[model samples]
Target: MIIDCIDKYELYQGLGDGVSKALEFLVSHDLEALSIGKHEIDGQCVYALVSEYETKPADSSFFERHELYVDVQYVVRGEESIGYAPLQDQVVVKPYHEEHDYALHSGNASFVNLCGGMFAIFFPGDLHMPGISDVPGSVRKIVVKVKA
Candidate 1:
């Protein structure tokens, strides 16, 4: 997992070639102007999903891990918290949905708060429970899905 400001995104471009492409797309575009939907950059190789919604409680969200993609999540308009835990000893609550590329797991997670301009990158082995906030509020975020 990597958490930092987009201003320093260039430092972690070393995450991979695809991550570099994803960061480039983010810096070159106006995310606030993007409508709520999936925007493709490199066919299925890279894409961003713009979402706006109210935040939920931690217990209400599930810890999910993806096998096919690395997530580059950025908050554009609000603050939210995300739970992260290594999947090493976790038990699956719901088996993986190959079509969706994720599986839900039951385990303890550490929470992190992110406001506008902040981003977090979760790799395949990183279990994440997103959309939780300290207080219920609306958040507009873009999750860039980069093929792993």
Candidate 2:
């Protein structure tokens, strides 16, 4: 789990080639104009999903972890609190589907407030529950998938 402002994106270039490309895409593009849907940055190896929706209560969702990809979740508009937990010893609430690429885990997560220009990177070891907010409102967010 890596939490930092986008201004510090430059400091993570050493994360390796795939992650560097993913960061570069976010830094170079005009993400605000992107429509709500999946945009392929480099086919399936690097792609982003733009979405806007009302935030959900954290208790309603479990922390999810992915094995094949790293998630770069960037908030484009509005503020929300997301959940995070370590994957260690967590029980699986849902089995992983290779096609969909995710598995839910049973555990408590600490909350983090994210607003516009902020992003969170969740690798295989980071269990995260996104789309959580204190009030009822919509948030525009982008989740960029980087092949692991």
Candidate 3:
């Protein structure tokens, strides 16, 4: 997990070639106007965030592991807790769904608190539970989906 301002995204460029491009695209685009659609870049799949709704605890416990995409979740406003667990440590709670491109894993996942100006990257092997509320209020977040 990495938490930093959007302007500091350049420091994370070398983390991976595909991730770098995704970050660059996110930095250059107007997140507020982008539609929630899937777009391909450099043979990689990317999902833009157009808007956000209220997040709750029930929405937080659904951990998913994607086979073809890495989730680059950026927090534009508010704070939320994201549940996570290492891939190797997960016990399959349910079978993977090929159509949805993800699986459900079982375990006591850890939480990463994400506030505005922060972000987290979850690879294919990482199980993540997003949309968790920090307080009783709602949190608004922008999720940038990148091909794994």
Q: What is the lDDT of every predicted structure here?
A: 0.91, 0.88, 0.73
Off by over 4 Å in 1: none
Arrange candidates, best lDDT first. 1, 2, 3
Report residue 81 deviation for candidate 2 (angstroms): 1.2
lDDT of 3 at 48: 50
Across 1-148, the per-residue lDDT of candidate 1 in tens digits comes to 9899989989998888889988888888988899999999888999999999999988777898999999999899889999999888888999999899999998888999999999999998799998997689999999999999
Q: Against the true structure, candidate 3 has what lDDT?
A: 0.73
- For residues 26-94, write the lDDT of model 3, one tens digit per residue: 687666565555555565466655446666774446678888877788876777778887788677877
**Regions of candidate 3 where Cα sits further than 4 Å from its true position:** 36-44, 49-51, 58-60, 134-136
Ranked by TM-score, the better of candidates 1 and 2 is 1
Worst 10 residues of 2 by lDDT: 132-141
Q: What are the RMSD figures for all models against the true structure?
A: 0.9, 1.1, 2.6
Collision pairs in model 3: none
Candidate 2 C-alpha lDDT tens digits along 7-104: 88999999877788888888888988999999998899999999999998887888888999999999888888889998788889999888989998
Error of 2 at 37 (Å): 0.9
* The candidate that achieves the highest TM-score relative to the unseen native structure: 1
